[model samples]
Target: MSSASKDALPLRHPVRVETITLRPMTFEIAAAQPDFAAIARHIGVASLESLKASYSLSRNGDRVKLEGKITAALHQTCVVTLEAFPVALKVPVKLDFVPEAELATLAAGDTGEGEIDIEVLLNEEDPPEPIVDGVIDLGAITLEFLALALDPYPRKPGVSFDETAPEAAPESPFAALARLKGSE
Candidate 1:
């Protein structure tokens, strides 16, 4: 295999916050999901073929900025046909992590979990995430993006709701009564 392909392979990296200085550290890393089957089951998908991310980390003041893109391939069951179909995604990753100790005070009535009404929540950006123990879990962050990118209701190409399809006729009350009597 060519060296270019080797460099493209996803590699796992656990970066310590202290290492990220004013200069941006670029990475083209990807890691194979060893527990792909189990995770696919938990994610309610047919299967996960691949998930990879390529990004850079830089320190801006006290916070660390993570900017990258996550690419994933998976099979999702179509709601219309109940058939699994392939899905490819290229999701943008942009988040900032601040030292846990330096986190700002919670807003009024905030549960520290950060909450906003639906209307404002749609437009508001999330607060910076906390960098716990000075290490960043790049794998976990990439997986999170994949989860968010999945379609809640997936449909295969050329498939749609068929309102013209025949529906099963409802049984009469007497039919159910007769069935119970016959069973007894």
Candidate 2:
């Protein structure tokens, strides 16, 4: 991979896809011990015990496809109880990287903004990703998938949020007058 492409990736723990070909390629990456702290902070976890990912890459013409899974063990604070707990997660990953030139060509022909169907794009079998500088950053991809898998409002077991209904709007000051008016 070129130096510029390398620089585009996260500096702490980078899992870059350098080579692209029709033949299948695979990679196994583990976060370095020194990078754990930074990664933990990035993921908003108390601590990250470990993070590992395995990826397979293949190319069809100019489009690149990546399939992988990430496993992570971490500590997180419960949103309801404010207590820290351990969480182990496995997240599946799949991506299709389309060339920028091709995307540009498509964009050039897209003169009608309202003609685009967002629902169709969202429902596609394979989510399309833009290839930046002819490379894919698997480490960043892993993080993104990890975030998506995590529960935004994690709660400890047996913890339930019983939201007490707001107190009845302070008895209206004009209640007595209103009651009298109604009776009359």
Candidate 3:
């Protein structure tokens, strides 16, 4: 990679709060493709063949709702076979970006475990994420969602491991005698 290309890479896209309007803003990620590929490697993937995200940001008072979809072509090494194969994933994006002030309120008002929303906790779906510096890093958030949706142990088709028990220790020749003694 050239220095100029590195210079062009952006770590995050922090959208300003004041600029947000009712109309949705579109952001494409080709300029930072290299950075995203690096993220894939960091997360144990062989490669991120391609990545693209389209999001619509809308503010509801202090909170921002980000809804979009991420389409990625990836290369992952199968855990069972150790062979790299291509995978195409289309992951849905639904996240609520909460302001720091509101987060403080939520933290202070927490009662106990009983009050927690079990549906949100148990599901693989993400809960509201914090927005920092009055900006939301949609690109970073998209990558995070992809990481969560990825299979931890990807396997090639028709690959399987047996779970049957070992044959009962070869029936002993004394088995019949032992059974007779136990009967008494």
Candidate 4:
């Protein structure tokens, strides 16, 4: 799928923007029946369930911020043994979104952006096309951030490391020399 298609997938629960304000805005959401399968798909995993995000969002001017916790259970293939392992995560997430123009200004040695991109700014190397809508999608932002934080190699408990077989013992040169001397 195209990157645009992937990023544009409908958010299970979208945060509503009541009014834009210069002051930091805060709100909480208890995700309604989160689509774990969809989330897993976003993370390139299979069959995730019982996922939820209880998060708060804040905005200051053109910069948007998200701080929250996500709890979920997932089934992932172990990188070592290839066995499926169930992993649970409750992670604290924080991120920031900044306007592209402001980011450029910062890169040009202007500290005037006020460090809004310090936490979760888009990659400087390949920044995303600027979000046209002043409104930010905090739910989508948090989910993507959580996906980045997931363990790529989840292992099942009690899995043992492989042991190498011992090598055969070699004959001692001193013992051979002593036997030859005795025979002489």
What is the lDDT, from 0 to 100, of the residue 18 in candidate 4? Answer: 36
Q: What Cα-based lDDT does every candidate model obtain? A: 0.77, 0.77, 0.73, 0.62
TM-score of 1: 0.70
Please provide, for model 2 over 62-173, each residue's C-alpha lDDT reduced to its tens digit, 9 standing for 90 to 100: 7888888999998889998899898999998888888777766554566576353333366557547777666677777887788788888988778899999998887776
Name the runs in model 4 displaced over 4 angstroms: 1-3, 6-34, 110-132, 166-184
- Candidate 3 lDDT score at position 159: 78
**Model 2 lDDT at residue 106:** 55
Candidate order by TM-score, decreasing, is 2, 3, 1, 4
Which tens-of-lDDT digit does each residue in 1-184 have in candidate 4? 3458646654534444335455555555334445555666777765576666665555566666666777767777776688877778787766666776776665556456655444445665433323334545655655676677677666668876667787977779998999999999
What is the C-alpha local distance difference test score of candidate 1?
A: 0.77
Give the alpha carbon lDDT tens digit for every residue of 1-184 in model 3: 3446433434456688767776766666542565756667655688877778888888877788888898888888888889888889899888787888787666555656536333334656565677777887676666677788889999877777667898779778699789889999
Assess every candidate by TM-score: 0.70, 0.76, 0.74, 0.62
Q: Give candidate 1's error at residue 173 in angstroms.
A: 19
Enumerate residue pairs that collide in model 4: none
User: What's the count of clashing pairs in each model shown?
Assistant: 2, 0, 0, 0
lDDT of 2 at 133: 68
